[model samples]
Target chain A: MTAGAGADAGVVVGVDIGGTKVLAGVVDAGGRVTSTARRTTPGRRVVASQVEDALVEAILESAGGRHLAGVGVAAAGFVDSAGERVMFAPHLPWQGEPLRDLLEDRLGCPVLLDNDANCAARAEAHHGAARGAASALMITMGTGIGGAVLLDGHVLRGANGMAGEFGHMQVVPGGRSCECGRSGCWEQYSSGNALVRDARALMADQPSVLTDMSDGHPDRVTGPMVTTAAEAGDLVARAAFASVGDWLGVGTANLVAALDPEVVVIGGVSAAGDRLLDPARTSLQRTLVGVGHRAVPRLVAAELGPEAGMVGAALLVGGDGTRTAAP
Target chain B: MTAGAGADAGVVVGVDIGGTKVLAGVVDAGGRVTSTARRTTPGRRVVASQVEDALVEAILESAGGRHLAGVGVAAAGFVDSAGERVMFAPHLPWQGEPLRDLLEDRLGCPVLLDNDANCAARAEAHHGAARGAASALMITMGTGIGGAVLLDGHVLRGANGMAGEFGHMQVVPGGRSCECGRSGCWEQYSSGNALVRDARALMADQPSVLTDMSDGHPDRVTGPMVTTAAEAGDLVARAAFASVGDWLGVGTANLVAALDPEVVVIGGVSAAGDRLLDPARTSLQRTLVGVGHRAVPRLVAAELGPEAGMVGAALLVGGDGTRTAAP
Candidate 1:
């Protein structure tokens, strides 16, 4: 393919280290992935170095000996506002780890690090669903909910670089107990885990195609299983989406009340598209206040596929991290 | 007293229009009020012109023949992003009313208009509790909750200027009903009304000092009466504060999770001081995530009293509006 913005900037590799896997990609300036590699994350149980080993393995394979510009790493963790260290990560063993500096020293090149949600938002802001919006909220629902705030063309990293931890925002008092030790978190009601929980609960009360799909074992049901069943017109799966989607709208309304963003983009499990967003829109309209006097921002699903994290990580490098360094 | 910052600039008057009162003040640049006047607010039932009449009376009274530099209006309503019109208010007559232009046409001087919560936040940011903080959240609780966000040096006004509407955020699903046509808003559990609700609920279970204080009528109880009772060491009153304060901390923990501000300033009912905030601080520490890992933003009461709205409004007209234009 002819070179675009990413290629013009030189060949750069981006890596997205998530809960279950590490995905690395060779990206061009145009936000397209030319080649990719993946590995099952060694995870937190292993030494922190082992996880880095898997990351390096994926990155080197994706580069394929191309002259490298720089590399960007987007990890599902609390990256400091200066993008210097990973303060903490629930799924990865990174606590106060200076991943960026360490990676730069090991690779002998530039390295950029940031929160995965922020990177995803930056990608949307630059090329995907949220382009041109002055203020936007990016909500990505995977095993849990992740969020990033964009204001005046920049991600609003808070005092501790933890500004967009939206999943923990309490939506229900004394409702569901969250792993965060807080009850009634928004994620407890609207995430991949919540979707599966709803599906399993639905099976207990009524008949479902999922019973056979999961071999009559509720524990066997996964998020992808429900999504596929719902796509094929299963009532139990569709109901679960409606339930989770409604909860998503409630939380979005709460956020809209606070931030009044110009747009909201739903990523992660967003391949479900209208099935998840249509009900959310209805609930958002019902829950939001001052509807007649104020503008209700558009809610849209992410345009990018699973590669959003990797592409967005690449965008963070921005023609190589040698210039426009992270602040 | 000699003038501080206010005298160095020209003479300015600020008006705060609330649900029940219209307070006007002649404020100097040093954030001090030299003279003041008050009038009962005509509220939303009256024609828009009548409310303006009350404002003009207070403005004239406070100015007391001093040459006016400018006038600022802090209304309990939604101010447009351009600061030109009052888009809507729960307790006032403004609905897309161009108060700024109308006042300028009549008085022939510059007029700046903004939301009362934003005005209060500006006061704290300029010279009160949040001074010198890199970022802060100002939450003022009276009949309900009012909030504003300060980032860097400027108040972070979002799209349509409706940012920081924190009171209406849903904290309970299918819980208390709010006047905003929503259920379980944060204000329902943590505002003046919530305190009274807790006090009245407590009164139902036992005989207490509130019975004599309110003349044996629960409806006769007022916020001030409860505060006085609590100050005098009434267990029931103290419990009510604890209840409301705990809810305040719960809601605050939610906000901190999302924004991670450097400071949180509590205004309005803050005259109770440690009586209210001590419980909130304890609960905030208990409920916040990553307790040992993240910095717990200081939770403090606002220093300015009832005059914060007026003082902040005056500051909006800094050194004359002809210089640093509002953008």
Candidate 2:
């Protein structure tokens, strides 16, 4: 195999099963998506089989009769250290489901499974940002934050394949309740949900474009609405990004203190780009320990954008059972 | 060279330079100290050479004219990734000092230097509680919190050699101020200083044995005094452990959430052992994300106790400059 993603090997399909959508892409050897299909995600409230059906539909739609090298599936959940079962998913109706085998049997091909953030990191490490770094941290800020750690270009899957769960780390004690049944998680203050929440909280006190955009209902304010208004130079929307970005920096500073990566690549809800990163970078520099004495890691937006998860998953088409096990 | 510590190799000296003391020990290959010496730490208020002088005096006293394999010095500071200079230290008056060269010059032998927490982790991974674990997180709760991360039996020093600096992670925003100039550092709530601070705060509420033990001077209460009184079942002192231990578990939970190591070995002011671990463990279980769904890393006490740092430093005696260098 040649260097750089082994792209000439064959075409592979990657599927990212997120909270609200099932996204599938047919990725060429050069880490480019040739075709794509999307399906509404039957979320955590639905049966596991229904979600699997949606995944199957999207995968087949994306395939478009192309021969497949294999399929890599990225899920928003606690993938077992073996990368075989989805022990639990905060957004998906999965509980110890052997997702790989089930998908393989249905599709008649080798199937690989990993965390969504790991897939995004793989995409970035191979073709996007965080390239050629000895160590990197990938944080995807969509919905809730998802994290992955790469050391020497390989994902450092901890004892349970659950390392890099940065979002749930407590940034504020008893500050905000999370769906994970914890309070004050980093994601609670820094993700898309957090962006929307802050916008709504700000709407309660002042006049804002968001109130009109969301039809005067705070609950209807979405992440996209806030980003759009922020781009249009709305003060309230800008305030939300500032608050969320500052918190993003605060949480990242905590991680930087512990992991000291070469760079941190942010993906998922990163459409705001500099609007999100500038504040985050400022706070990262302000809060990191030994700030002036050591190299401050650079914080940058992810190069792969929304397609990163699927592109990274597609890269896993090759074989390595080092962290893969099936029962 | 042999199965274990290579005890047949030769005798080496290990020195741990802390904010309060310079502890030196002559350690054999079996990780046992044959002789020990201690001197007061000159601290951040003094010049770097004065601190270095104290270290030299203690190392000579411990050596007692025995032949030496080499010397390994562990500093409670940010040792650069090359293990050459101490970039900065909180308690010691070191600011990017060429510590290894300084020690090697005076002693006329090879000198290895590393962060004290990294040294402690090496000792535990080799001969103590975390032995045989593929991935381990070591948190030393002494005057402040120190952390180290090991992957595949080697320390994962980050891009700046500052990985595993877990103590500065912010658990409470705008909380307590730390010497590092950051507010709400994890150590501010869960270390020896935290123990003393909490004990003193409790003393202000009611008449406790600590009040009499400190001679009614709340500021005079020390970590050992609190530990001693807690072991003796003093209610107020026990309350302090409950607070510190719970915070310990809280900060550890954050680290575990991020690193997800196979084991977490806590040392340093771990003298309280169960009094510290039991409460920490309970809180860890309650706070860890996906707690029941994944393998919760076992939190254990450091077996080598205070000597782990010196022993680990000694382990660096015969090594390639894998992460070591001197100018």
Candidate 3:
């Protein structure tokens, strides 16, 4: 924690507002957290005001005797260039909600907002995983796929302030129906949801050990359960993981062909260590276009773990807000 | 000419060395041509040393009495980072050729080399169709498809300096074989060759206006003939343009979904004054992934015409080897 005092004592508060949980931390200039707090996200029907109030409360609790420099909130949705409003968030009840303005008013400080994946990318670029790289692409595979791009030591926000929507890129024409009302999106094949769906489908077809592995409770077939079963040499779970890995490789290959970044850092629940990446690496080489001609961007697991968004949020306050700063 | 003289007064020569022709011009600092020279390309069987000598002669002849600043050559294939070598050009017999050193020695001036497409994109960004834009994707649809990406006013050269090889991006798996040993690339559907192939294929099977349009010479079908027939309202030729336009839209949509540039400039023989671009514009929206959600990047024909690459080459010299020196 002593290292935190050397960088900049802006006393930044990092908040990761995810679908499953709301994690907040008070970070010093050197990226050390002095106080932390977490809470389950409000229910599906919760209003924007309620979520805003909860976010403000969490910030105050985490602040604990520290003066605030600025606040960074990582929300799961499309954030516009201004970083004050949420354009869209399917999992959250924030449609065109001025989350940044609301938070700033409540906390008495400047606020910056960005997509969760972009937040994770910034964190990796600032402190872990993709640190010191000129360019990198961060992919977070959980219930769904999420992505962020860092170009020339900064994030690439496209013309409309919307880039790195890589999860929505078509991986298959008619593979699976995504909640976005599109089929064959990268997320549907290479995500935690994809793993669970494959596991359930496999269990239904052949009476595999995974069905018995889950003890006949088909509904209990989770991503981690499938991973554990695969590690234990279960055929169905292994197949499911392999399927996810294959799709991961396909998506990564498309990404490499398009962006040509120096490195790709994989995170999220599906990446849980190396099970997903091993197959992904094998498939990446196989599916990669112009294999031997171009330099293959390195694929590595994210080193910052799940708390990367929070750390990145804290780092944003200390780093250049040139583009990712509060408007 | 006065505008050219008003800028920096120092002239720089631009040489375009293609497989079929070698074109050189002395370009003033303001993009005005002072003098010009042209010659047919030398035999491909000879070593690059002979070819370099021929190009140097053309450049010196074009230079005439102009006090030169430098020379920028737009080679037909992949050019290295230093803009001094032709790394690989399948159509042209050049492999790891030190083009700049050879030319600088012969021409007695500093030399810059870059792929024709990159130079074309740079040209459009500086003084052509994409002028004043923050970013753009330039697609040159000639006998082959060539591409370049301009980001923040600089051509985006990837890790291996081979980033803008968009024509080689696989559009269809195992589809029409290419000379690059690939199948179903974007260029296969949208290039000049694609136009002729589709026109010939239509002439053979479907009984349509193409037979009468071609004046019974079915074997002599060409891109220009199709353009003329399309203007005359030939259904088959219109269909051919539509087909190419469809693929152009698909390829451009893929790019739009990835880069999200402010504009997409269509150049080369296919653009032949918006005959191709009219349908391309309509199809681009239809094929766009998030059609209704995002602002579509403007699709336009190159204003600098076929000389875009040559003009861009001159601008490189005018800028004195610093690519981003111009507006």
Highest lDDT, which number? Answer: 1
Q: lDDT tens digits, residues A25-125, model 2?
A: 98765788888999999889988999999998999889887545578888887789888899888788899999989998998777889988888888888
Across A212-302, the per-residue lDDT of candidate 1 in tens digits comes to 9999999999999999999988899999999999999999998898888999999985568888899999999999977887889899998
Candidate 2 Cα errors over 4 Å, as ranges: A1-10, A35-67, A106-108, A319-327, B1-10, B34-68, B91-93, B105-109, B319-327
* Docking level of model 2: medium
Candidate 1 structure quality by residue, lDDT tens digits, B97-135? 999999988777788888888888888888899988888
Which residue pairs show backbone clashes in model 3?
Answer: none
Task: List lDDT for all candidates, in order.
Answer: 0.85, 0.84, 0.74
Q: Candidate 3 versus the native: TM-score?
A: 0.90
Scored by TM-score, the top model is 1
- Each candidate's DockQ: 0.71, 0.78, 0.40
Query: How displaced is residue A274 in candidate 3, in Å?
Result: 3.8
The Cα RMSD across the true interface for model 2 is 0.9
lDDT of 3 by residue, A165-248 (tens): 776665454457877766666788888999999899889887767777678988878877888888888888888888888888
The fnat scores of all predictions, in order, read: 0.76, 0.85, 0.21
Clash pairs detected, candidate 1: A5-A29, A6-A28, A6-A29, A6-A30, A7-A29, B5-B29, B5-B30, B6-B28, B6-B29, B6-B30
